[model samples]
Target: MTKSSGADPRKTDVKVSLIGGHRLAGATLHERTVTASLIGGADIDLTDVGIPDGAELRITKLSLIGGVSLRVPRNVRVDVRGLRLGGVKDDGPSEPGGPTVRIDAWGLVGGVSIRRA
Candidate 1:
C-alpha cells in the first residue's frame, strides 16, 4: 500500500524489504541492479517487479510465500533460491539467445514460467 526508495544510486546493488500486510502491485524497477537478495513474505504480493532492458539482476536468495513475478528483458541473468512460485502465470513471450537467463529455485515454483523477453 505504501512505497519508498533508497538513496543509493549506483546501479550495482539494491535491496528491497517488505513486511507486515504490505502488498505491492504493478511496480517497475529500472536500470538499478540488485546483487544478491529478493525477500518476500505471505503478506506481500510482488506481482510486478520489472527490470529494464540489459540490466543485471541477481537474486541469490529468494523467499516468496505469497507470490512474486519478475519481468526481465532478454539476455539478463537471474538466479533464485528457496522461492515459492506456485501462483504465477505464464503470460510473457520467450527470450532469445538460448536461455541466457538462468534460474536456481530451491523451494516451490510450481506454475511459474521463466520465459524470454
Candidate 2:
C-alpha cells in the first residue's frame, strides 16, 4: 500500500483519519470506544487491540482503498461484515466469539484483515 504524505498518524495530532496513502498503528489500545476510516490507498495497522470488561470497541468504518492489517487481542472478537461492494474482508483467526468489533467496511477494491495479536 502507498504511504501517506501526512504527519505521524500515531500522534494525537491526527484525530480520526487514515487516508491519502496514510498509515496508523496503535501499540497498546485500551480505549473502550474507537473509530477508524481508511481510503485512497491508506493503511491502518492496529497491532494490539483492547476493550473494557463488558464493553465494545467499534471501528465505525474501514473503507479500504489499498489494504489493512489489524492484529486484535485474543480476548476481543471481530465482526467486520458491515458493507461491501467489490473487494475482500479477512477477519483472521476464527475465534468462537467475544466482544463485538462492529466494522462498517467499504472495500470497494482493496483488502482488509483482522489477525491475532
Candidate 3:
C-alpha cells in the first residue's frame, strides 16, 4: 500500500508494500541503482522494466498471481523467496548470465523464465 524511494545517489532503494490478493499490473521501475522489495501476494506485471547493472531485486513473502518478467541488464542480481508464479509466460532468453538471478520460490506453482537480449 506504500512505496518509498531513497534520495541519496549512493542509496538506491525502492520499497513496495502490497496487501494480499491485490492486483498490480504494468508497474515499472527504472534507472535506480539499489534494491527493490515486494511484500505480500499481489498480481504484478513487470514487462520491459529495465533493471540497472549491479542492482538487487528482492521479492519475498508473497504469491505472484499474475507473475513478473524482467528485461534485466547484465550483472544484476534478483532474489525471489516464497513467491508463487501463476499464469506466467516466459518471453526472454533461457541463459542465466546477464544477471545473477536467485529464486527461492518455495511455494511456486506456475513458472518463471529469464531471457537476455
Candidate 4:
C-alpha cells in the first residue's frame, strides 16, 4: 500500500526477512506519523526510535515469530503493551520523560524486549 505521509518515511514492512532494522537518531518525523508493521518469522531490531524529539511512531502490528528488539534512547517516554502466547517482554531503563513511542505488540512463540540505548 502507498501513503502520502508527506516527507516522512512511510509504513515500514518486513516480511519473511532474515534481518531487519531501523534508526532514527538524527532523523526527522516532525509533525509526521510513522508506523511499522512486522509480520512473518524474522527477528527485527529498531534503534533510537523517536530520539532527541521526533514524531508519533506507532507499531500498529507485530506478529513475528522470531520476535523484535527495540532499542530506544534512554529517558524517552514509551508506551508498550505486548501479548505473548509463550514468551517474555523486558522493560528498559526508567523513563525520564521525552519523546513518545507507542507500541502494540503480539507474538506466538517469540518475545519482545525494550532496551535503553
Better of 1 and 4 by lDDT: 4
lDDT of 4 at 81: 64
lDDT scores of the candidates, listed in order: 0.36, 0.49, 0.39, 0.48
How many times do residue backbones clash in model 4?
0
CA lDDT, candidate 3, residue 19: 31
Off by over 4 Å in 4: 1-54, 86-88
Taking all chains together, each candidate's TM-score versus the true structure is 0.34, 0.53, 0.36, 0.53
Tens digit of lDDT per residue, candidate 3, span 1-110? Answer: 12234664333224344433333332443223222234333334333455444444444323433233444333444554444645444443344544344433433443
- Model 3 off-target regions past 4 Å? 1-20, 26-41, 63-93, 100-117
How many clashes (backbone N, Cα, C below 3 Å) per candidate?
3, 1, 3, 0
Clashing pairs in 4: none
- Model 3 — which ten-residue stretch has the worst lDDT? 29-38
Model 2: per-residue Cα lDDT at residue 14: 26
In model 3, the Cα lDDT at residue 114 comes to 40
- Over 67-109, each residue of candidate 2 has an lDDT whose tens digit, in order, gives 4455667666666655555444454554555555554555566
Can you write out model 4's per-residue Cα lDDT over 1-117, one digit (the tens) per residue? 123366655545332333443333324333222333344432323353434454445553345454555566676565766675544455655565566666555656555566766
lDDT string for model 1 (53-98, tens) is 4444333223343233444445444444445546445455445432
Q: Is candidate 2 or candidate 3 better by lDDT?
A: 2
**Ranking of all candidate structures by their lDDT, best first:** 2, 4, 3, 1
RMSD (CA, angstroms), candidate 3: 7.1
